[model samples]
Target: MNKPTLLFTAALLTAPALLALTACQPSGPVTNAPETNANSVTTLPISELPLHAEQATRLDNNLWLGVHPHGDIQIRDGQGALVGQQPVAAEFISQRRDAQGDFFLSLTTDNQLMFYRASAQGISDLHLSAELPWPLEGMCLYQPSAQELNLFVMDESAIAHQLLLTRTQGELLAREIRQFPLPPLAEYCVVDDSTDQLFVSEENIGVWSYNARAESEVLRKPVDLVKPWGALEHNTGPLAISQGQLLVAELGSDLLHAYPLDGGDTRTWQLAPIAAGQPLAADALTVSADSDKTVMAVLDDNNGKVYRAELTLPARAGDNQRIVQVAPVAETRPMRKSGDAADDPAIWVNQQQPELSRIIGTNKKYGLYVYDLAGNELQELVVGRVNNVDVRQGFSLKGQAADIAAASQRDRKAIALFSIDPLNGQVSTAGEVVTTLDNVYGLCMYRNITDNRFFVFINDQDGRFEQYEITDSSAGWRGKKVREFAVKSQPEGCAADDRQQRLFIGEEDVAVWTLSADAGAPTDMTQVAAVSDVLVADIEGMDIYRSDTEAYLVVSSQGNDSYVLYQAEAPYEYVGRFRVGINAEKGIDGASETDGLTVTSQALGADYPAGMLVVQDGRNLLPDENQNFKTISWDSIRAVVIAP
Candidate 1:
């Protein structure tokens, strides 16, 4: 296949004009002045925030929280008022504050450490601390001695999947001071100075603690926090130490559990529900002491709002603590085609009737195939390259009131809309080619239910997106030019959350982008979560799945043979990453690569049925070697979740 030359030609022809347009715009209008006062009690309406909030910590009296929605760190007072916000830098995905009142942020993007000291003047203290040898996820301040301000960071070293504790005391830095390798899929970790303990939370398997000063010590035996609760749900959340007791935030039940370190007593408190209509997906939390009151800072992920609640610890009796759902503000599916060999998938579903899904997938050397939800390969369409496909239903022209419905069905029957022989996988061109798409790697389908029209979005490797509208069709299907948008990097895989009017685009080395629908452009983009060092090669496919208020964005790492799953935090939250283990049959151990990924509710029905993740195994083919695709069921995935 020829590398898309048409897109390069279009860029060459339009570069100068675009440069001139950019040059004409003013750039000095923005300044670094503090936008809001430290005590400013500004309340960001819920509509402007993220969908879920994860990872909440107390930075002295002022609480700092991280949200997955937009990957922003928000600062609030003890009274729970939005004081300031800062978009996390590209290098970091997680952050924690130290005892010296310095925010220790984990720069997972670049495998470095950042220190942001928040003063009364807001985020005026930002410093680039020491860089780590490997990427890290969880971080906390380890104050072993009062005179030293040492930071402990957790590194995801694949060798043993251990947490490399890097201690830094000014110029004296020790890399890999201590290593704690736990079972795979470890959730949250915290260094408790009060008890001199390090608590690590594992999924299904409860909490484990070890001496902070020990080099390689076994945890204080294991505690099975979750019992055999059948196949309904799983437990995952953050762990912290409060008043010599270990506090575990159960995300599955939205409950904060308090277990005594001395094995004295156990108490569970239900967090207050957020305000009416507000979604509550708590990621991480921290409890703060205020002379007379015990306050807790919770990341309200639903709307990307941070909330502070008053905590009343039990004095002597077995009474439970009360938690009130406080107010927080926050931010912020498929189709296919036909081909015997489904290469790429493009989905089209009516906005009003999303259940009526239509998919267009490529057959590579053969042609395209159309399919319904029932796995019935309907028809096949043909096109050049046929590397990717996109479908749009009920498209309208600027001046045409044509019968598109009758035309769509008729075209399917005549095999004239595009061209494909379902039996033999051959292309018979009937429709004329529109604008040539350059290195088209990703595709999306957008349908306007109000107007009953649709637009097809194609991501070209030349850093541009082409949009085409299905036009008036009497003989078959005809496409018309709609619009085009510029991107910074080559787009790999993309998924659109039409219900939320947002599009998630995965680029090469860059972090994902969340674009708005009204402007048909990106409003905010941040580099938060990435797939280890493998992302440097490229990110391939992405899919968006939403269940009521919760949303998930799964991205495929074409270079690493893994998949990175992100939970939409207050605007979105970066749930921890889950890597699919390659099996012997898949030949992942060989030089084979894992490419495209599609997640649906289909797998939730069999054993897992909560939801299923389907990955494409790209096996290496020698000059005479041939291989077929292998599927990993959700049951196998759940094993990875529990596999140490």
Candidate 2:
């Protein structure tokens, strides 16, 4: 048994003046202290940066800042001093500082807007600016008429929705000026000031553009953005705009896409590997307009930090540009290797046992592995084909021995109870398997804080979902079917927002289904967002995160190639899309069929301080392969934009 540790909570009171003073520093600027030196910086050759560039800009004269190896948004100068930085909170989506030098940040913690004034003294006067009606995922800063700064936030509320042109004075005081409804879980939006239109990228559906002036309707026909390469990865980062062209980062392949602003032609630029063996996460990316050229920054999540380089244009002189890699900055911790078959990671933060934080990962062959915050495998529980797993506390009729015994004898002769051992990584059958669920794909634990009752939601491969009650203890659980819902297609991923009493289900080649627990029975199924296009292929994994008032749904496309991220629609809106994949060259013998995904936002352990997303590379199945798992740093994963 893992011993539980005690925790105490104490409120620290400080004078408002002191609090204001610390806010001025805003986590302190990256200084060129003795800690960071040029000798410590590694500069790969320009050819190593790979991908051909349609357009490249020089942001600074000194050195080209590539992607940050670390996850933090710190753009460094040639000397390695932090030039620009943005601080993000848990569940927060995106941050930007406009050309006017005003800083805008989103708070996923509560779907609120926290603004900061950046002065020479640093970031001071932090204040809450606006309260969104619902939680948000992706956000962008646009100048509608050059007089006002319009903040557009993506909300996947009921379907896909958008908060249009919320005008804010400067960057701090933001108020809602208008709103618009969009397709479910739109990935990213780019404002074409040249045409007074906003182009939104909807994963599987295509790209739709709406007139900023006419908020009621879409202006352009939806265009298909799918590439032969496969479904794009999800949650990489923001798209880039350069010289009448939109640059989109492809998550599955090492390719940068260029879409003509006039909507005439689309082309792809493949990035070459910087090092012979180095892998690229391509999570987050930033572009800067330099005096003479355009510079781009791509974050490598597989490695810890960012890569700064120059984008080289095409040979047409105006069409071709070159991207050069320059410097790298180190983050707090080095990226760890994601475990083999480590899928669907869930965190159980014990309030009664605060220090007893445990992360349970589903391993198809090895059962569930519990790990401490330090990334040490504490124990492994043997559950067959553990596609999905969750934990909650409580008892229900479904888990009662009488129910299990009756159900076991009536249906399958097997019992349905599990026993776990923390120290020895062992699990034994506490009861027989009651009913062999047909294609059990997803699982979640629903806790009723009000009554302390726990419920389980499981998604079956046969286009149906079942609910059960837990009667036994945390380790030993018996389940009885309470309700079932049909999804039409294979239901691969499922997540529950207990606070909101909502569940998100991902269907293959269909939209995501949202079910309200408050309504009697599980039949009240509604199409919250469509995944037919957003996910490259069939949706296989899903996870929901609630930060304050907002809820985020992350769905995996096991068949296609990437993960799709959606914000709640009716109560939320489609924010943006992110892409996930192992770097192109890093693939085992250069293959790209990636399947199975699991994500967590809170730090699971010390090694994974910011949280993690684990995916399975189908290419690694070859018996001759040296390693079974490929782990990318979560920080690096959030650095680049999967699509522009």
- Off-target runs (Cα >4 Å) in candidate 2 are 1-343, 350-356, 373-376, 381-383, 393-433, 473-476, 569-571, 581-644
**TM-score (all chains, Cα) for each model:** 0.37, 0.42
Q: Model 1, residue 247: what's the lDDT?
A: 64
User: What would the C-alpha RMSD of candidate 2 be, to one decimal place?
Assistant: 22.7
lDDT of 2 by residue, 509-543 (tens): 77778877532554777877765545555666666
lDDT of 1 by residue, 1-644 (tens): 11111111111214455344234422121111111222421232211122124545555555454434345556665555776666763322233345555554444244445455554456645544455575555655554323223344555651112222233343223233334455455656766654446666656544545545322223333433343311112364676655545667665444566666545545555555566644456665666555544566566545445556555554432312111010101000112322223344544343433333444455444555555433355665544345444433333333432212111111111111343332222223445434565345566555555555555566667767666565555555566656677568777566666556566777766667766543345445555355455343467767765666456776765554445557654445644344432222222211124344555443232323444444433432211122223233444443433231
TM match of model 1 to true structure: 0.37
lDDT score, candidate 2:
0.45
What TM-score does structure 2 among the candidates reach? 0.42
Tell how far residue 397 is off in model 2, in angstroms.
Answer: 13
Off by over 4 Å in 1: 1-343, 346-360, 369-382, 390-433, 436-439, 449-452, 471-476, 519-536, 569-571, 579-592, 602-611, 620-644
